[model samples]
Every structure is written in C-alpha cells, then in structure tokens.
Target: MLKEFTIQTPSEGFVTITKQVAQIVEQCHGEKRLCHVFVPHTTAGVTINENADPDVVKDMLLALNHMVPDLAYQHGEGNSPAHVKASLVGSSVSVPIVNGTLYLGTWQGIYFCEFDGPRQRKFCVNIL
Candidate 1:
C-alpha cells in the first residue's frame, strides 16, 4: 500500500512526522512489511534523527549552511543550495514494520526537510 501526505512547513526547519507514519502503520492492521518513505522534490528530503532536542536540528541547519552556503551555489536559482544539500542528505528512508509498529530508536524520529521556504510538500509512504 502507498500513501501520500501533504505537509505545510511554516519555515525552513525540520518537521517531525513520525506520528503520522505511525498512524499509517496502525491503519495497515497487523500487516508486517517494510516501509519506505520518499520525498520527490530536489529541495527536500527525509531523515531519522534525534527528536528529543531542538538544538540538534538547529546545529544541523547551521552546519549544512556552513558547508553549502547559499551564496556559494552557482545554479542561479534561489534554492539551488537547498537542492544540493538535499542530494547530500537524501530523499528517502526505509523502516522495518513489525507487529504493525515502526522499529525506531527511542530518540529517533522521522523528519521532513524543507530547505527553501514555507510551502506545501508531499511525503510518500509505501508498504511492501
């Protein structure tokens, strides 16, 4: 089964959507499968990271900006740097589903990467 979700990011930051995925798992109703989450946009991505601390997200953004500064990009598009960063990070994540639950670390959460702006984005979850 595959599902697509719409997310509205208020700003350029990490937005955790673990709960949404969990709900999707619940709706699967005892099916054991592998879950793949994918983001189709070049300026966006997905990851599993520490959810307990807000500072981690801040540090990540700061570090990425330091590594790939917007001014340094030559693609000319305002979001060219964002596309590069997303490529480095990636656009998909896979998780094991057992007993209808996602297997994740205690501190780990699924996040949608929004590097460009406050816009609507789509996250896809596929179970197989």
Candidate 2:
C-alpha cells in the first residue's frame, strides 16, 4: 500500500515530521512492512537524526552552512547551494516497521529539509 502527503515548511531549516509519519503508520494498520519516505525536489531532502536536541539540528545546519557557505555559490537562481546540500543529504529515508511501530534508534527522528523559503512539499509513503 502507498500513501502520500504534503507539508509546508516555514523556512530554510529542518522540520520534524515524526508525528505525521507515525500517524500514517497507525492509519496503515498493517502488521509489518517497510515504510519508505521520499521527497521529490532539488532543494529539499529527508533524513533520520536526533530531534531530541535542538542544538543537533542547529549545529548540523551551521556546519552545512560552514561547509557550503551561502555566498560561495554563483548560480543565477541563488539556490544552487541548496540543491547541492540536498543532494549531499539525500531525498528519502526508509524505515522498518514491526508491530505497528517504526524501528528506529533511540534518538532518531524524521526531518524534512527545506533549503528554500516557505513552500509546500510533497512526500510519498509506501508500505511494502
């Protein structure tokens, strides 16, 4: 089975979407399946990481900014760096589900990366 949804990000940063994914899993009502989440965008990505600490996300963004400084890119759109960063991070995350729960590490979380400004983004969820 497959389900898709859209989320609006406020700005260029990470937005935790664990609850939303969890809700979808609950709605699935299946015994066991692989949950695949995919984002289709050049300037956006998805990842599994620590959401318990805000600083973790902050430091990550900071580090990424340091690595790929905003002013370093010469793309006309001014968002070429975002596309690069998204590519580096990736555009999807797949998690295993068992007993109706996601099998993730203790501090792991689902994050939606928004490199561009506030916009509507879509994600696909496939239970297989």
Task: Name the best candidate (by lDDT).
Answer: 1
Q: 26-128 in candidate 2: lDDT tens per residue? A: 8888778888889988899998999889999988888877877767667788888788889888999999998898888899999998888699998787777
Model 2 misplaced regions, further than 4 Å: 71-74
Work out the TM-score per prediction.
0.93, 0.91
Scored by CA lDDT, what does every candidate get? 0.88, 0.86
The local distance difference test score of model 1 is 0.88
Overall local distance difference test of candidate 2: 0.86
- lDDT by residue (1-128, candidate 1, tens digit) is 79999999855788999999888888887657888999988898898999999999889988888988757556777788888889987999999998889989899999998888788999999887
Question: 80 in model 2: Cα distance from truth in Å?
Answer: 0.6
